[model samples]
Target chain A: MSFREKIHWVTLVTMILAFGWYFLVYPWRIVASPAGVMATAGMLVPVTIAIIVAMTVATAFLAIRSPREVHAREDERDRNIHMRGTHFGYYPLVVGIWINIFLIFWGIGQAEQLNLMIATLVVAEIVRIGTQLYLYRRGY
Target chain B: MAKPPFTNDIRTLRFLAGEMTQGDLGDRVGVTRQTIAAIEQGKYSPSLEVAFRIARVFGKPLEAVFQWDDAGD
Candidate 1:
């Protein structure tokens, strides 16, 4: 595969893994007792750190495995794909962020309500990367 | 920026230049390799300056490297 495609694959996989780790910890909160919830939340930080470390290591391996292609500059098709994909996702990003800010303004209540901002950014990134992968596969 | 109604023979040029690499040419032309490939694919048109630079690398006139095509329906 092309370097662009490889980079896309690496990024997509890493993002998904991060999301997977997040869901594993956050969505299972009900299973835990009060102390368990605190313990789980505390464990989340380290799990997140581990996920990041894994992603970094995997990316490094992929990059090393194909230095020529990975380091090669992107070509027209890649740029076009990226441009079209970024523009496609930009609208959703703006809208998602605006809604998130509105949620904040409405005082969504929880101290962690502000955490929605991070979710918004994450979702936008996911959308952007997904769109890029789709466009690359579909062509510009 | 808008992509102009233009096309190029970069693929053919690449063949003729003793199989010059897209990356090497991109380095010389001051663009990302992806941009070069996009231009060659007719998906994205480059700036006039870039177009001229590309033409210069092949020692051809700008028109020789690129031209307009109205075949799009």
Candidate 2:
């Protein structure tokens, strides 16, 4: 696999694991309360930190293992795959935003809305990365 | 995925050119090794500039490297 493809795999697994933990252990019972928002904010700190650290470590390790490929620039195929991934990702982002807007007008709780937004972003990211990975595997 | 509408003889040319590695060819053509592999396998269609560059690397005319797959049509 290319260095970039390996990094994408790391990112995909990291996001899924980190967010999976967050959602599963989240205090969903308090999702309608102010404390729920605080909980979301509190939990996000560690999750963000974990993701950053994981990605940094993975990239460093991969670069060390393949010093030559580390300096390789993105080529035409990589750019094309990236554009296609972004094209697929945009759909979920737009849909999420529209849903969030409708929920706001419908009087959804702040924490609920916040969680929804977070889920939307997470899903969009997954779709984007997944699409890129697919293209990479397919040699596009 | 469906195959590209055209085909190429990169593998054969590479063999004739002292068994050039895909990585070497990719470096010469300013693309990735995987891109060259994909092009050889007909899984990807390279851009016009890239196609010309690949032909140039082999010292062959463009049509010698790649040919239209009239059978596909």
Candidate 3:
């Protein structure tokens, strides 16, 4: 695999594991309460930190392992794949925003709105990265 | 996915040119080795500039490297 493809794999797995833990252990019972918002905020700190640290470490290790590929510039194929991935990701983002807007009109709890937004972002990111990975694997 | 509508003779050209590695051609053509491989396999269609670059790398005309597949049409 190319260096970029390996990095994408690492990112996909990391996001899956980190967010999987976040949703699995989240206090869903309190999702309608104010404390639920605080919990979301509190938990986000660690999740963000973990993603950053993991990406940093993984990128460093990969760069070290393949010093030559580390300096390789993004080519046309990479750019094309990225643009297509972003195009796919945009759909989920727009749908999520529309849903959030409707929920606001329905007076959904603040924590619920927050959680919905978070889920939307996670889904969009997954779709984006997944699309890119698929294109890469497909040799596009 | 469907194959590209055209094909290339990159593999044969590379062999004729002392068995040039895809990485070497990519470097000279300003692309990744995988892009060259994808072009060779007809899994991807390169931009006109890149196509010309590949042709130049092999010291051939563009049509010499790539040809349209009329059967696909």
Candidate 4:
């Protein structure tokens, strides 16, 4: 596999794992009292930390595994694939944000609103990685 | 499905040029071997500069290496 493809695989797997962890903790937060909810949300900070650590570790490992390919400049195909993935990824993000805005205007709960915002970002990332993986497999 | 708009004889040309590997051509052209493979498989159309570089690697003119397929239109 190309260095870029390896990077994509690492990112996709880590993101899914991190988000799955977040979802598993989500219900626990809902069942908490107001004070307990805040405490439970505090656990989310570790999830973010875990994601950052995972990304750094995976990237470092891949870069070390193929130092030459890592240093090589992006070519036309790489740029094309990046742009296409990012562009398509933006769609779900925009839609999610708009829905959140509509919810705000309609007077949704603050905690729920915040959750939606976080979910939006997560879903956008998932879309971005998924689209990139698909494009890489399909070729551009 | 319609055929790709572009096609090339890169695999054949590489063979003629002392059986050059995809990685060798990519190194000459400053791209990844997968990109070369993609081009060979008609899954990609390279930029003009890279296309020229590939042709230059085999000491051939760009037209001799690559061709446009009107059937794609």
Residue-by-residue lDDT tens digits, candidate 3, B1-73 = 6888888899999999999999999999999998888888888899999999999998999999999889986
Q: Rank the candidates by DockQ, best first.
A: 3, 2, 4, 1
The whole-model C-alpha lDDT of candidate 2 against the native structure comes to 0.93
Go through the candidates in order and give each one's DockQ.
0.27, 0.72, 0.78, 0.61
What TM-score, computed on C-alpha atoms, does each candidate reach?
0.72, 0.98, 0.98, 0.89
Q: Which pairs clash in the backbone of model 3?
A: none
* Model 3 alpha-carbon drift over 4 Å, by segment: none
Local accuracy of candidate 1 as per-residue lDDT tens digits, B1-73: 3455777888889789989888788889977666677678765667778888999999999889998778742
**Local distance difference test, per candidate?**
0.70, 0.93, 0.94, 0.83
As a whole number from 0 to 100, the lDDT of residue B47 in candidate 4 is 88
Q: Which lDDT tens digits does candidate 2 get at residues A36-114?
A: 9999999999999999999999999999999999989999999999999999999999999999999999998999998
DockQ (0 to 1) for model 2: 0.72
Structure candidate 4, residue pairs in collision: none
lDDT of 4 by residue, A1-140 (tens): 88888888888888788878776767544532455456447857887798889889988988898898888788888888888889988999999999999998997666677677778888898888888778777777
TM-score of chain B of each: 0.87, 0.96, 0.96, 0.91
Q: Which 10 residues in a row give candidate 3 chain A its minimum summed lDDT?
A: A131-140
What is the lDDT, from 0 to 100, of the residue A56 in candidate 4? 90
DockQ (0 to 1) for model 1: 0.27
Supply the DockQ value of model 3. 0.78
